[model samples]
Target: MNISENELKMMVLKACRGIGLPVAQAQEVAAAMAASPWALKQLLTQLAKPILTASFDFSIGLDIKNAHILRDFWACADAAYLASPRVCIRGVSSCDVTEALARYRGVSVVAQGEDLLVMVDERPMLKPARCEVAPDEWQQLETYAALTYVPETDASRLVGAGAGLTDND
Candidate 1:
């Protein structure tokens, strides 16, 4: 696709603003696009993929379900997600899912598609990753679900001090 510099710049700015990012963050994103259009394009594409796949945490237990939310969740999961692996969580209330499924292991859940996916070492993370803030305003949740997580991934590294989880088993 032929992406004009101005078009990319506008798209980046619009996306940042639409996501409710602060002025500084929006400007930083815009600057990045202006300075390196190619890199910015790649990042933009990555950001958009969140709508394709996602993993969801039931802790919050959203009262109402929205179709858009489902779409975003899957986008976050990247389609390849299967919610395959899972980690056991203690103190978490029971739900419809199997109980013996609980193992209190490394990661707690894995799904093919959902927004806000997490992974470590490119491996599907079984643990639910929670954040005080959702990176994208489009999704309203403090936690994320996905097929995998990468410890080295930029987002994975930002978890606060001692936010790490250990198997309770």
Candidate 2:
């Protein structure tokens, strides 16, 4: 079947996801493949190996949505993760990772399953680096995260746990 470059990256993404790699990692792998023929060939060879079940064990994770954020965060966090796998991130979600990276500095990003946790330092280098969202836009992001987040099988309730919350709550 014929495919476009974007489609090929998505296919690579799916393959990475199948192995329990988080969305950010899958995206990184797909992007690397798209950028270099040598990387693509190496990835294909690796994918061709005998099948084996393995758990996701990488220590650090990034949860970014777009290329700008991907590049920016990669520049910031790559060394930390490469040095050790114990760095943890506490963060929120946004459709624009590039904007987020540009706006926020001194933050850590962690991946838990398909989710990205954006952890901010207690004292950010820039005092007001966090993005300021309009009420409507903030609502939309919250709704999106709520819809996509899957509660565990053992969990008794949703995140709020019957806290009598509404979209505006």
Candidate 3:
């Protein structure tokens, strides 16, 4: 399926949020996915992994030994963007997604062994107007995004869900 960059971002944002990522982190992941739509598979993989708590230190950067890629990568990117010229993240399972995110954040990433070195050097790229996505991947993303929706119910309708009580107004 072919979708505009904005559409992809919104879908990814909803998917990330559906998986329980905080709004800010979800937005970051969405922007990264939009920047590199080809990384959708990696995004899905990362989403399926167990979410783990990350440890960060100004002096030590981010250590993701037991952490999931979705949240910790962005956190490390933010840290690199703000404080250090370069930050090292260990045990990154989704290098492609991490690289995409680093590009989105205008940072450079170099993988060394099982670790990633992110530096605040690169400039963010402009997103393409349209990108091709595998139909299966798009469907999977839709499935995840669907978790954000509220199921239709009579009570919800009365409260003004969808078209609410009337659409003629």
Candidate 4:
């Protein structure tokens, strides 16, 4: 429960890699944390409310048969996008779950084939959100699954540009 400041920074760095954050961007965030860990932590704590939620349509076919794996994979992709509001892609196939699920989230697919693509929002640091749903939610929806995405409540700690910044920025 009580992670040392150094540990927290390392955890953030690891998470950045997990979500495929560009090296430079990841370093920038890590540096900011190293400079002012308390500032970032307070910012995160403040933004911890009024969670964002999204539902998706997963009617597309999948080669993977394990529902749990499939669910976790989809959740990771969705969380990546929600966390960054950018095109977070996974899988190699042109038409894999990554593309199908992204479309369900109402985000535009900038490119596809070999790997799914989405335009990076480059907006100021959005917190990664937790995706949750009841056990029978997927079954009840019949190919459609509703996930509640609650972003990190703190806004001040968030790094990155706000919607005002363009990808070029």
Choose the strongest candidate by TM-score.
Answer: 3
On residues 76-135, what C-alpha lDDT tens digit does candidate 3 reach at each position?
A: 777777866557777764367877887788877777788777778657574746799999
User: Candidate 3, 153: how far from true, in Å?
Assistant: 1.8
> Relative to the true structure, how large is the alpha-carbon lDDT of every model?
0.33, 0.42, 0.78, 0.36
lDDT of 1 by residue, 1-169 (tens): 3545554445555565554444454444544444444343234333443332224444433211222221222222232233433222222233212111211111123332331222222423233222222134213111111112224666656663455467476
- Residues 1-169, candidate 2: write the lDDT tens digits: 2334565565556665554456786576555444332233334434333433322334454323322233234433554434443432223233333223423344455566544544444433323212223344333324433443456663555553666445663
TM-score of 1: 0.26
What is the C-alpha lDDT profile of model 4 across 62-157, one tens digit per residue?
Answer: 222212212233443444455444332334333332333333343334445543444323334323222232333213222211122134545643
Rank the candidate models, highest TM-score first.
Answer: 3, 2, 1, 4
RMSDs, each prediction?
Answer: 20.0, 16.7, 2.5, 19.9
Q: Which candidate is the best by lDDT?
A: 3
Looking at model 3, residue 80 earns an lDDT score of 76
List candidate 2 segments past 4 Å from native: 48-77, 80-169
The lowest-lDDT stretch of 10 consecutive residues in candidate 4 is 140-149
Candidate 3: segments with Cα more than 4 A from true spot? 61-64, 83-86, 162-169
Each prediction's TM-score versus the true structure: 0.26, 0.30, 0.85, 0.23
On TM-score, who's better, 1 or 2?
2
